[model samples]
Target: MSEREDFVRRFGGVFEHSPWVAERAFDRAASVGLTAGNVHSALCNAFRAASPAERRAVLRAHPDLAGKLALAGKLTAASTVEQASAGLDRLSPEEHQRFTELNAAYMKKFGFPFIIAVKGLTKEDILAAFERRIDNSPEEEFETACAQVEQIARLRLRSMLPGEDNA
Candidate 1:
């Protein structure tokens, strides 16, 4: 594959479904030769600099935690693994129902799914955060979602590149 294609193939899903973040970060990655930290910073800078609508698109691109996409086995590969890591994939019926309710409420209030980097968190932790964040103002929720997206991207890059201050 060509270098650009390779770059995108590797890092595109770092930002959920928003490959545009990878597309935008490519120039920087090329310039800096693809260290984990450089690639992570480039991708995050692109995400952070996006217009509100574009950033919201990134947020909207995320699958809801333990929601329909996951139920239907439709989450991206990275998402599947991450959710499993948090035990979200093993939620009981009651837990799933609670996630469903919180997801609906959160979406109704914020116009996007509740997003958190689930790498080192438990289902209870995620549930607690979901409940707590539902009370945030729209602006606060938007910023929080964006930051979570960045964290997710950072973790994804860390997995791919390893051994850098991608944190």
Candidate 2:
């Protein structure tokens, strides 16, 4: 595979199932030069510039927090690690039920899963966020989901891209 192919393969999951984000970023930067310094910016731009439907699909690609995928051991490697970091992997029966209920309600309300960057948050924080965000209007929730997805992607990219800060 060429360098661009490798870039996509490696960074594709930076936006969950959206490898096109990396592809567009790589192409845009190719016209200039895709250096380590600018790759992150390019990827962010590509994500931000995606069509609304593409952005929604990217948001929908995320699994629900502490939901079935994590229970079934089916989360992607990055998701598994992030969920575990938030102690979402160790919920009690009651906690798990609460998460299940909230996940369903949030999706019903917004037409997409509730997404938060689970890396720095505790389970309590995650739960509280769910409660608070559930009351948001659909438009508000959609924008919030988009922002959270951006945060998740940035954190994942920082780990994947060497010489990149967590900023």
Candidate 3:
């Protein structure tokens, strides 16, 4: 089989589990004109090298909302904000209201909604991050966003290939 085909067959499992992740992987591959096989191979190899906690960490680095502020430009900020709010449903109503207030304040201060990869964090943890990061300067926060995006990509690659070495 061609390398591309090999990659697809080996990593197709990832797509089966998370279509959104698969789409992002495919989009990344397409951005570089990589054959499906090569993209699959890279993704599989990356996934294979990551530990479970590392994978969760990667997911946690993504912004809860997308769109105007998403590094990938695939999700809108409003949608991402809604998603974040929904994910916090475990919170008491009062806590939820507090989060909403904090989110608004974060947006006002930073000129962008607070972004966190919300794959694996509890509502409490997410809120903690908001509290901690709300004090960061714009430069610091921008750097954080960039770092989180990279982490998310790495995790996505690792999920696509669970046994391969990335390095």
Candidate 4:
């Protein structure tokens, strides 16, 4: 594959289903050098410069946290690992039910899945965030969700290209 094509293939899904972000970032990467931190900043710059509608689509592309897709084994491999890292994959039935309810309420309120980078957080931490964020105004929630999406992408990029210098 060509270098751009290979770059896209490696990083395309960094922002959930949004490959365009990676494609755009590759253009910036050509000039900036493709170190992990530069690639991350390039990717995030593309994401932030996108129209609000595009950003919202990226947010909507995310699966609900510990929701039906996870239960049905349909989350993307990255999502599966990230959620599992936070013990979301091993929730008790009661915990699962609580997550389900919170997921529903958050989506209903915000028009997108409640998103928090779950890497180091426990289920209780996630639930607390969900409960608290569900009360944000639409404008506030949109920005918060977008920021969370960026955080998720950062974590994914860091995992793929690990180094203290990458931070």
Candidate 5:
């Protein structure tokens, strides 16, 4: 089989179980020229061989909200924040005002959105992280951002490939 095919077969195992996610994964892989079966297999092998922490780190390295005009290299960062804040319309007016203020301050302080992977996290957990992280120094916040990016990427990978050895 070709490298891409192998990649699709192996790493794709995670995604294949979820066809919608698989399609998106395939599109992403293809965009990066892992379109060949063998190449894909190699990529999958590499991803699978990584330690769980390493995988998480890789995910975190991405810029949040990849394509957003405001985020620049921080697309994933923006998207994660947006996703986490999705239900904020349910908040009271005061709560909404506080969130907006917090978000603005976070951006002003960190030069990026406060980001955390929302998958598997409760809304309260997300809110807490946002509040707590705002107190971090720029250097500390940068590292925290990096960590969050990895977490988000790992979560995306896991969602894309469920049954595979995520480690």
Candidate 6:
């Protein structure tokens, strides 16, 4: 495979199950270039160019933090590690139940799973965010989820490609 193909395949999961983000970035990289410096921005642009439905699909690709999929070990490798970093994997039963309740309520209210960039956050921090965000209007929460997805993509890209900072 070509380097661009390799790049896309390797970085595809940076946006959960959405490989289109990587593919779109690679298409731009072909004309310009791919570097640790600019790859995240390219991907973000690709995400931005996506249609509303497509963007929603990308958001839907992400599993809820500490949701059933995480508990069942069904999340992608990147998601598993990200959630674990927030100590989600070691939740107390009561905390787990709380997360479960919150997850369901948030999804019911917003029509999508709640997302957070959990890498640097404590579980308490995540829970606090969840509580506060649940009160947001659906439109506000959707925008928040999109921004968090971008944050997650940047973090995942950094892990796969060294020397990257948020851009």
Cα lDDT listed for each candidate: 0.91, 0.86, 0.53, 0.90, 0.51, 0.85
| Cα RMSD to the true fold for all candidates | 1.1, 1.8, 10.4, 1.1, 9.7, 1.5
Better of 3 and 4 by lDDT: 4
**For residue 41, what is the lDDT in candidate 2?**
69
Give lDDT tens digits, candidate 1, residues 1-167.
98888898888889988888988989988998788888988999999888999999999999999999999999999999999999999999999999999999999999999999999899999999999999999999999999999998888888888677645
Candidate 4 residue-wise lDDT, 1-167, digit = tens: 99899999999999999999999888888798877788889999999999999999999999998888998999999999999999999999999999989888888888889999998998888988888888899999999999999889888988888783573
lDDT of 3: 0.53
Clash numbers, per candidate: 0, 0, 19, 0, 29, 0
For this target, which candidate reaches the highest lDDT against the unseen true structure? 1
Query: Sort by TM-score, best first: what order?
Result: 4, 1, 6, 2, 5, 3
Off by over 4 Å in 2: 30-37
Listed in order, each prediction's TM-score against the native is 0.95, 0.92, 0.48, 0.96, 0.51, 0.93
Query: Which of 1 and 5 is ahead in TM-score?
Result: 1
Question: Which is the leading candidate under TM-score?
Answer: 4
* Predicted candidate 3 versus true structure: per-residue lDDT over 51-91, tens digit per residue: 64544444433343322233345543333443455465345
Q: Tell how far residue 120 is off in model 2, in angstroms.
A: 1.3
The runs of at least 3 residues in candidate 1 whose Cα sits more than 4 Å from the true structure, single-residue gaps closed, are 165-167
- Runs of candidate 5 with Cα error greater than 4 angstroms are 1-89
Residue pairs clashing, model 2: none
TM-score of 3: 0.48
- Full-model lDDT, candidate 5: 0.51
Model 6, clash count? 0
Residue-level lDDT of model 5, residues 70-119, one tens digit each, is 23333334344545455532555665566677777877776666667666
